[model samples]
Target: MNAQAPHRQRKSWIIWSLVTMGLALFVGANAHLAYVAFASQPDCVSHSKGSGEAHDYRAAKSAC
Candidate 1:
């Protein structure tokens, strides 16, 4: 059982390492997406002038 101790510890360490790396990747991707969302400014397009129109696109309140 003593010889198996090191092997089990190594496996546990590998598993934890993989989990940490995956978590880091997920957090990094979310951060990048948030940065892009805040940094990018989209140009306004033509939209419906009147309200209560069917199948029409409405501009946002903060639209430029």
Candidate 2:
């Protein structure tokens, strides 16, 4: 019984390590995707045409 204990303990450690690594990877991926989604800016912009404060404005979407 004593001889088999070390092997069982090692197996358990490996399984737990793998589980922890998987969770970490999952969390990291989600964080990266969230950052990309929120940090990105819209390419569309509004431009003013004509002269003076009474100028007209035009809106267009960009290729971004």
- Model 2, 1-64: lDDT tens digits are 5999999999999999999999999999999999999999867555654455655544344343
Error of 1 at 36 (Å): 0.5
My TM-score estimates for the predictions, one after another, are 0.83, 0.65
- Stretches of model 2 off by over 4 angstroms after superposition: 45-64
Candidate 1's C-alpha runs over 4 A off are none
Local distance difference test, per candidate? 0.88, 0.80
Per-residue C-alpha lDDT of model 1 across residues 1-64, encoded as one tens digit per residue: 5999999999999999999999999999999999999999889877676677687767657465
Worst 10 residues of 2 by lDDT: 55-64
TM-score quality measure for candidate 2: 0.65
What are the per-model C-alpha RMSD values against the true structure? 1.8, 8.2
